[model samples]
Target chain A: MTTPNPTAAILIIGDEILSGRTRDANMYHLAGELTRIGIDLKESRVVSDDREAIVEAVRALSAKYTHVFTSGGIGPTHDDITADCIAAAFDRSIGVRDDAKALLTAHYEGRGVEFNDARMRMARIPEGAELIDNPVSIAPGFSVENVHVMAGVPNIFAAMVAGLLPRITGGKPLLSQSYRINRPESTVAEPLGDLAKRYPDLSMGSYPFNRDGAFGTNIVIRGQDGAMVEAALMELATLFPAEEHS
Target chain B: MTTPNPTAAILIIGDEILSGRTRDANMYHLAGELTRIGIDLKESRVVSDDREAIVEAVRALSAKYTHVFTSGGIGPTHDDITADCIAAAFDRSIGVRDDAKALLTAHYEGRGVEFNDARMRMARIPEGAELIDNPVSIAPGFSVENVHVMAGVPNIFAAMVAGLLPRITGGKPLLSQSYRINRPESTVAEPLGDLAKRYPDLSMGSYPFNRDGAFGTNIVIRGQDGAMVEAALMELATLFPAEEHS
Candidate 1:
């Protein structure tokens, strides 16, 4: 495992995601998983199923981040061209692999479904790619070079990622602490601002919410150093005189 | 309104959005809205509140698309720094405009709340910026040089976009239709594959969902042409053998 901070970026593909028809649960789940593994999620981009756009985004993200995890657009449908776009981006030939075919055949056999041509298309893998296991669905997501491509359906995506993430290296796991402040963001900005200056490493964010017609805030403190996060929490505690101090 | 096709992009900026704590509802809402108005949503990107990232995304998107609507990071808190980022990107100085100050001042005064420095920070606009009306909260989201920066909160974002969308020129509105197939995607792939060959302008997609412990498929047809989308739908209907049709 490399010693330096490992950064990962997620490229979420699909017109559904961009259109808001699907409330993306994968990003949050992946974020928590990446955080636990000490990976800094430097960036996440949502792009439609347009092949050229997908190819361009994949190239930009894959080149910049240590690891690139793309969710969605890997199905058998026409819009499911993420695998093809990824292959094009990496200059890899798109073809069916024996291993992926075997996995899909076994999965379909277990379900008592026919291993037809459309179903077989899921077995198409970028040349020289390693399969990422999908426990929920038999057709697996795949990883090539540094890019991991997975399903768009939340559960399948989560399962595919769960199988893949443990195998990769991560950075210093960030420690996170949050407390709800039953006051407007204005009420806490100054002290929170001061605390940020004091804990330069910690990323302190104040999210204002409207609860029961009364304004409240959730102050989130995040950093690689647990002690610094706790110290920031202590500083935040002094700022608002909050009832619940975590 | 000279329009061959109106094109728009959305820039969602928030650590919360990137973290997945906040499922981005605005992207969907805005995408649907733009589509309804005949504006093709060519691209959508989500970046964190990092000034450089925001500036970079804005500059790039603003250059590519006709209109760029951004949501998030326009609030009283320091992390709400989208305004500053936009100002920096456009090489314009940030200043509290008299109009924004008056609106905030009036809203706060009406509510009997103190319009302090933090609250006043909401009034800061980039030079040469035109304010997007926020009817929900007095704090307005602004548009500077083809970039419309709105609030990240769904309600405010929706409200601002509603007020702003009608003013812009939209191209031909998108036409869409869908039908469910009782059979698996495997059964219909060959025919759908052949159909896709005939309709080059239309985008066709099939989503497989597990219902009653069996796989069911929903085929969606989308395109700028209304008659073409309906024609494709009819072709799909004939191919699928729908309950009503047969």
Candidate 2:
């Protein structure tokens, strides 16, 4: 059997998320991006901006997965302590690196903004970490070993992923196709279960919905093999023939 | 000193979310609700619908937090294995509990639908577990000790939460106030950090935004004490002095 694809975990460090002040946009974005790049996103965790919590999760996820991506807490505020936590997790010392400082220094100085201590905080990269280019913002995200520290802001996060994904060698891209049936999920579960048994290598998920008082289920079949996914979708489409509005 | 409020963690079990086919709605909904009820939402984790993963997460979160709310994988489909995992985690024998089976039976009977084996899967609850009522859907979620296993569907999960929250006693509701300053986050970080140090009990988070070619920062102050939060917000207002368009 072929070797299993590389696995990944996301560690979202933010008090804003845990406190419910902000709904997560970063996790969703990264999950989709990672899927597109063929990296299996195994687990995602949102933790408060507490040092112990951040360090523990960082170490655990880093050890468990092929890659551990972290978002939030890399900003220029006291609450932004992810860089320090990552350094501590790997037992390395953190400091304001000259290269990182130069990037921010140039960006701010060009805009006539002072590279103050607050802005300089963004330049605090862990020792022996490579900078991930940020096209949206000047403050760079860093990657130390297996952990990729990214900015939490949605656009910046997306930009960093764009720059990072191309550098990592990913496995086959997962292909998926979905079928919508105008029946309740309970009615379709048995057949779906049988189909799942037939295709043991593929994953089938049924999501139910109630829209305009009509009960319906959306069946999504996914696998690394595009032909298999297409065949399964074809079989599903034939079994649950499309209705007028389906 | 006040007794610490009960802490909670959200465990989202769904392969659909891990694959990025679906974004999480249940976690965000529960997070806000728990925040309002004075329950500290310590962490939120999303794991795949694998048995070992679910069981390990359930055992870990259940042990660490006062409550563990899990969403997804309790549906009628074959992929739905949350109830089984929870049972296995707690070493409880699981079968079709009569009370739960009867509810689904009657609901299906009333609607003139046959309650087949697929539908019967919903009634499988662990021994000696309290049923969490799902008003929207007749299939009941069960509470195995501290772990509350709910449906993956957003509406069903929410209905179960609405029924479940009333029974739990929460501490003082965490109160929060926010101020929008036209200055960028880097510019406001120093003062916001100072304010955070002054009010050790409160959490201060500065979220930066860019809209209409203008950059601004939204600073949120949170604490269990309402008056203290008010006092801090007032002080923040005085320090920043809200601008006309702010």
Predicted structure with the largest lDDT when compared to the true one? 2
Clashes of each: 3, 1
Tens-place lDDT digits, model 2, residues B129-222: 9999988878999898999989988988999999999998898888889899998889889988888999988888888877776878888988
The lDDT for every candidate, in the order shown, is: 0.81, 0.89
Residue A36 C-alpha lDDT in model 2: 85
Clashing residue pairs in candidate 1 are A19-B28, A38-A171, B72-B152
lDDT for residue B90 in candidate 1, whole number 0-100: 90
Q: Identify the CAPRI category of the predicted complex in candidate 1.
A: medium
What DockQ does predicted model 2 obtain?
Answer: 0.78
Candidate 2: misplaced stretches above 4 Å? A1-3, A243-246, B1-3, B244-246
lDDT of 1 at B69: 90
In the order shown, the candidates' Cα RMSDs to the true structure are 3.0, 1.5
- Which lDDT tens digits does candidate 2 get at residues A1-246? 234789999999887888777889888888888888788999999999899999999999999999998988888888889999999999999999999898888898888988899999988899999999987777899899999999998888888988998888787778889889899999999999999999988989899988877788999888888888999998888788876434
Candidate 2 chain A minimal-lDDT segment of 10 residues: A237-246
Model 2 - which docking category? medium
